[model samples]
Target: MARKLTPAERLATAEKDLLLEEIADQSSWDQFLVEQAVFHFGQRHDEWSCNDLRDVLPELGHGFLGAAINSLRGAGIIAHTGRTVPSTQASTHGHRIGVWRITGKGRAIAAQRRIARARGRAA
Candidate 1:
């Protein structure tokens, strides 16, 4: 008689199948990276300042990071606490000293992307 698989074995097999499905669903790398960044920032949502984000992604030069931040804000993925400050170069500085906090939608998207990546790895 054939023996049935153990509970652990069955779970592992199911997990592997689920992972494959997730990998197949991912569209591109940019989507993956954005999801990752959002997720990373979401973890420390309360402490994430624009400077903190820049530090986390040092490769994203200031201009690029600024654009990304704007994009996130526009997409409603992040929001500011509504505080502002004047800079040394008040004439040229229009940006505020805002702290970024990820929205619930952002967190959910990030979590979905992470799950997809994890599933891909399992596959």
Candidate 2:
């Protein structure tokens, strides 16, 4: 007789399927980077700097965060609010900063990621 699959095994299979689906649906690397920036920014809807995103998403190449931010802006996934110097840079950079926040579309993408993660966990 065939053995029944364990709950953990089932979950792993489900997660793998979901990951494959995501990979197939995702666009190019630049697009993924832009989406990631939007999703992360959505978590902190408040304005964030390029460095902030870079720190959180190390997978992104150096200066790639800025490119992602620009791409997101073009896609209307994020918008610039203004800039402020963080405490760390207030002295050296003289408070030179650029602020950005996610848009409605960005929120939608973030919601999708949450749903995907939930589905993965449920499986």
Candidate 3:
């Protein structure tokens, strides 16, 4: 069993959730990032990190992609793969970063989106 969150921790969690929702609502970037990360990298590889995501996503500013990825994980779209690797960014001095993989839920949603896109194009 895990320790329950304190009031401050709970408040911080709520604040973060609201901010992530606002970021998603403000533009299409969040959805695009999901597609690019889930379909692009998630399809070709079994595991990835923000390094891989940042490589493909040109629009998100520093820290934004990390936030988005956290949101995705919260939504059950991706999960830690029980692996870690040194970040390729020289700025990090090879710090360890978590590896992640798309969850079944993520793959299902991607398939549904693909079908919808196909139908839209057909129509």
Candidate 4:
């Protein structure tokens, strides 16, 4: 037999569902962080090594970082330079690392997002 929920219980259940939805959206938030990182690199006009990004965003797991960067590359948001730098991590045994640069499209997207963010903050 199913029990009926009181009004207060229904409200609590709705809030719980909302919280769960927010939690599920965290992946999107992390993706946004990855985009922001690439945008920052583009704005600086500097090629960013994977290790560099990892260092800057230590809170993001290595797997997530790799996947995020891969997603960006696949989406044409970032391109890899031929130049390789030594990995900052101790685990690398003389293996070179690829450097990433944001593409023109990425730059334009970043700029637009920056302006939007500024406007949002002002509002």
lDDT of 4: 0.63
Candidate 2, which segments miss by more than 4 Å at Cα? 1-31, 34-38, 57-60, 84-95
The clash count of every prediction, one per candidate, is: 1, 1, 0, 0
- How far off is residue 25 in model 4, in Å? 3.4
lDDT tens digits by residue: candidate 1, 3-98 = 643322322232333354554554433433443464467556664665565556545443455555566676666777676543323454656566
Q: Which stretches of candidate 4 lie over 4 Å from their true place?
A: 1-23, 26-32, 121-123
Ten-residue segment with the worst summed lDDT in candidate 2?
Answer: 5-14
TM-score (C-alpha) between model 3 and the true structure:
0.65
| lDDT score, candidate 2, position 56 | 62
List TM-scores for all candidates, in order.
0.53, 0.54, 0.65, 0.66
Model 3 residue runs over 4 Å out of place are 1-40
Clashing pairs in 3: none
lDDT of each: 0.53, 0.57, 0.63, 0.63
TM-score (C-alpha, index-matched) for candidate 4: 0.66
> Which residue pairs collide in model 2, if any?
11-123
Cα error of candidate 1 at position 123, Å: 2.1
lDDT-better candidate, 3 vs 4: 4
Model 2, 4-123: lDDT tens per residue? 433223222324343655555544455454555445665675677755665666564544555666766776767778655553333446446577787776666556667878977898
lDDT of model 3 at residue 34? 53
- Compared with the true structure, what per-residue lDDT tens digits does model 3 show for residues 64-123? 666656766776777899899888787999999989897887767666666766766798
